[model samples]
Target: MKYTPVQYKVNATILIKSEKSGMLSELSAFEDLSIVKNNNKEVENEIEILKSRPLFKNVVKKLNLNYQYFAKTKFSKRLVELYDNTPIKIIFKEDSLIVDPFANFIISIHSKNDFTITEEGYDSIKNGVFGQVISTRIGSLIINPNPDYLDSFIENEIFLSIKPVMDIVEDYKSRVSIGLVHQDANVISLSLNTTVKAKAKDILNGLVEEYNIDAANDKNQIYENTASFIKERLSIINTELSDIEQGVEVFKTSHNLTNVTSETELFLERSSENKKGVLETNTQLGLVDFMNEYLKENKESLLPVNLGFSEESIIRIIAQYNETALRRDEVLKSTTLKNPIVIRLNEKLQSLKLSLKQSLDNQKKTLKIKLKDLQRQDSVMNAKIASLPKKERELRDIVRQQEIKETLYLYLLQKREETAISLAATVSSAKVIEKAYSSKNPIKPKKRIVLLAAFMAAFLIPIMILFFKDLLDVKIKDKKEIQKKLDIPIVAEIPNTNTKGNFIIAKDDRSIVAEAFRIFESNLKFLLSESNNQTKTILVTSSITGEGKSFISANLSIILADPDKKVALLGLDLRSPKILEYLNLESAKGITNYVSDKNLNLEDIIINLDNIPNLDIINSGIIPPNPIDILKSKRLQELFVKLKSQYDYIIIDTPPINLVADPLLLADYVDLCIYVVRLGYSDRELLSVPENLYKNKRFSNISILLNDVNINSKKYYGSPYGYGYSKPKSWWKF
Candidate 1:
């Protein structure tokens, strides 16, 4: 996976900590407004814009992501995408290209300017030069080589895949991740993962550029509006100032006034001080009236800010009102005046407008009071100068008017220049804290870690399967299965032996198998000690055929056949006899022959083995047609009665209980019943038959013998029953 493709994460982090910018426009706008701090919502909104579809749409269109190029070197199996650093550049003729049509082709480069275009689906190849425009089914394509990689891509195949722009945009959007760096910091981080590092960097940088462009435009709207207002005010003020100056010249020339008397000069100097106060008061009143009228006329439009208002509150309110109005205008552009955001902003504007008007009215009343006080003082000074010439007073009035208009004109003109400079220089809104930097290593499919994980999986998977196989196994693997499934006591465990013979016990043998049967004999002595009968009959049977009932019976009888003891190994399985085949003996007449012939006695069916002392084997001789009927005969019970009195111990082997009812039919005749279950052979579900037979008293004194036990297995020899114990593997162990 690591060798297949390498992807790098190109990240660009920016702080949305925009202040009332120091840009000429924003600075001019901020003069009347309080500094509004940037908030988390502003950062959140900026993040949304970073992920906006339209913002990314422009990036995709500018980068031409829809028209993709991939370079495949001769030695490489995967096609490496050619992003901004593409080896070969393809320029399509806009007019000749089909609109958003799907096309795929491979260009094999032999030289810097020579190439062959082969359509992926077509067998034909079209030859083209670097500068020539070649017309094809998809478009008129002009193929060229990048100067930096001109020689490097001589034998490379450049593959082209053109898709729809919408598809490319959606793909780009899905790969982009944008979020805040800190919840309260108003810092945003944007990142994208792609195979081509140059393309990823370009995309992030382009998105930031477009986002700032949008913000600059929003902030520029109010400044441009204010600048236009200042220009109009300056034009009117300039013309009025010019006329006032001309009136002063006309008044002086008509009066023929060249010089003034000392007395008149003294009175004029005193009156001028009063005139300055009146002028300032009137100027403020005029401003207030003009702004009030402007607000009434343009209720929904942005108010011209930075006007000289005496009241700081009025200036701040006007700035706020204009911003709300501007916000409304923007919202209305995409939707309607009825939109909730527009409606809310509109309502806020109305409220701010009312507040601004009241502030203007309050400022106007204060100015009027100041103007009245100044005018009254001027009237007293004029009365004192009543004896002076009326022409001189008229000349003084025109000069004062000229000064007032000129001062007002220059102030407006100064504001206009500042607003114009602000208009020209709209500072960026997005401040990049860190430029786009791609990581040095690929973000995914780390080669070393992946190979290590795969290597370990190869070893662990099989071990886990074997472990689970043992964990989930249902076979009666040990005496634990017998003890866990059945409540009955387990009498003995027969150790597995290499000897194939059914009877493995010998008087002189001291092997583990031989000692195992001796222990079995001791367990039976304690179990049958309470029986009043002189001899004990042991019946051995199983749930399934291959569960080693015959092996248990033959070995047990041979072990019990002591020098002073008489033991008879009876084979009651008339249908299929296995004792003669196991002992390698031939018998013409046995249990079946005696049971079939009413005149025959039990001695005729019993065969004595000369190789051993006091050990007699009864083999089922003539194969009976109906074994169940033959076992049900009155002669069968009488035969067991004679064997019980003659033999000290009789071990009877019968058919499997689950396969036939022959063993269950002899349940009443035995002193002790041994249910043989082969380890690793019998199913766990077969234990239910013995448990049920023991619970139902189907046999007297039922005991389980775990046969063919693997004594070398885990913790088997130390167990209570000395049966091979199989434990499920632990979950963590492979």
Candidate 2:
């Protein structure tokens, strides 16, 4: 027969038996602090409680297998037979299974001798033969026996020398480790490395059950006794509280203490009011002291302004005095002080000062009278509060006794109720802080650390990949990037237009876009000053197509045109016309046809709109094969000259600069070039193209019009027009 070697390791912890279901360390501190109050009495009570507990001897006696010999023999029969023929013997010591050899035989590996036995043979067998005696079960010996020796022992040639199995009750009582958790500890750390996880937990559970049951029984008995004591005291307390309450009621009625606290509060309030009155009177007296000192210096005649009077009559006199003094100062500045007019002013000042002195005397007498009245009232309130006193003190004492007795009785009643509930709901004291749990990895070959390492390795690779991807992305995302790369003034930053329709600026609609266009129109006059020229020709373009160049040209033209002026939006983006699509106009005939025919007049290809008051449009007419050559013709230049005379402002939506040369060819005709750069969509490096055009004077006035800008972005700093204008309601309503 062959046996395979296996190992099991488990870890578990138990909590100390606590009186309640909370942190044991904190409860122990409270208990220790309470001991100073009734040390001897509490100690005697605890001892009596321990002595009266149900004896665990009966439970231990029932757990003993030796009392049932028949069951014990049956349980150990197979184990005894496994070593029957060998010189080795098996014995049950307390609760442990022990094995030993009777003869002085040599320890051997595979029948090859390793060491011989001596007088102290059991220790030799324990240390030299089998390593540590962790655990054992039936038919599984700590040391494997020789088959020949086992057969001989079974045949009666070698006798079985087995010791008597000790009592299980004694072993269970002694082996179980149970006590209060440490003052600094809330749990017990148990390392039950044994044959199996279930057996390790079974050991812990048995100890826990014993601890919990004992604690619960003891706690129940204590609560029951305490409840009995409270029941007897409660009757006495109720009678005493009733007697004291009745006595207090009689005393209170005799002394008129129905609203004693209100009386005391009233007294305190009166005192406070009197104190405030005294303080105000004292402040007025201080003011009078200052006034009297001031009057002593100006006894003959007082200047009202020097008194710094707040009274109405004094203020009037001071005003007149100031006016006369001012006239005197003016005369001194320009003429002699003895001049007739100055002398008259001096006489008037003297009369005003005399009147002010009389007013101060009257004010001083009035304040003195007010102060005397306030002081008399304060004295009367203080005497009244002091009048009733000795009877209140006696009543207060009697009432205080009643209150104390009532409060104590109520506290005891509540405590008794709580104790009764606790007695009824008595449960176990000890708990399993940590259940028996083993590492998932095998005991012999560990793998928990390896698995953790593998998990971390898998988690970080993708995070690093995403970080690198974010670091490499460098397209322009906001206005800051445009400012950093381009060297031009961003004249207008048009916030994103979220309406369903493309054209936001119209005559009838007063939306945020319209307000923004108005702001743009205001900024435009400063950006491009038309000092001498009657008409302004603005060319709007970008470094590439789809940069919102056409959108700015269409909206800007509508904003430039007022009810009195004419503004034309020309779809000069001949390669791809967008103004007609934006305004929902037909691409019938425009600059293309007008330039192709030499006889075409100013009104030949122009289209008018009813939706916008003074705005007109010139569609791209037809998709030209070579639009640059057509734009460079003398007829196209002539067409601009005619439009300049007729229109107040002409907004030409030209093709993108890098894509076509039509804008640079007609640069001479344009008064101002607004280069549009769309945030997030246009390449960052392409901003330099417009920047170079502005620097080299490609046009008279050139600036960037950042289109579709995110207004909420931090790069915008803040909104320019405060989001939108608050339009006024029409006064010509029905």
In model 1, pairs of residues that clash are 24-422, 25-422
lDDT of 2 by residue, 1-734 (tens): 01222335666566544334433333354443221110011222222222221222334333332221110123333222222223343233444543321222222232222212222234433222422232322222234345455333331221222222234334434543333245455565545444345544555555456545655654454456546645655687689778888887888778776655666668758667655555454444444454455456643332322222336786677556654554355345436777997788888887877786677678777767876887688668656755557777566556645655565566557657656655665545445777767655446433565567778878887888878865775555776777787777778878777666686575765666677777788888887676468788888999888888878988898788898889988888888888888877766778888888777776878788877768888887888899878887888888888888889998889888988788998788788888888877788778778878877888888877877777656666444455454445379953
Q: Per-residue lDDT for 1-734 in model 1, tens only?
A: 83477888899998674454334235565555422222112666567667767778889888888878887645567677887667777789999988776879898898877889998888889998898999888789888778887787787788899887878888888889999888878678889988888888989999998888877776677777777777777788888888888887787788788777899888878787788888777778767876877777776667776667778898788777766665565455447777887778877887898888788888888888888899899889989888888987787778778877777777677667766666676677778889889999988768899889999999999999999998888788877666777899988888777565455566776667777888999999998998888889889888888888777888788889888999999888877788777677886588888887888877777788776879998887788898988788988888888888788998998888888888888877888999888888888877889989989998879899888888767748532343343344579975
lDDT of model 1 at position 734: 57
TM-score of each: 0.67, 0.38
| Residue runs of model 2 more than 4 Å from their true location after superposition | 1-470, 508-510, 717-734
Whole-model Cα lDDT of every candidate shown, in order: 0.79, 0.60
Question: Model 1 misses residue 192 by how many Å?
Answer: 4.0
Maximum-TM-score candidate: 1
Q: How does model 2 score by TM-score? A: 0.38
Candidate 1 lDDT trough over 10 residues, lowest sum: 32-41
Clashing pairs in 2: 84-154, 85-149, 85-150, 85-153, 85-154, 86-149, 86-150
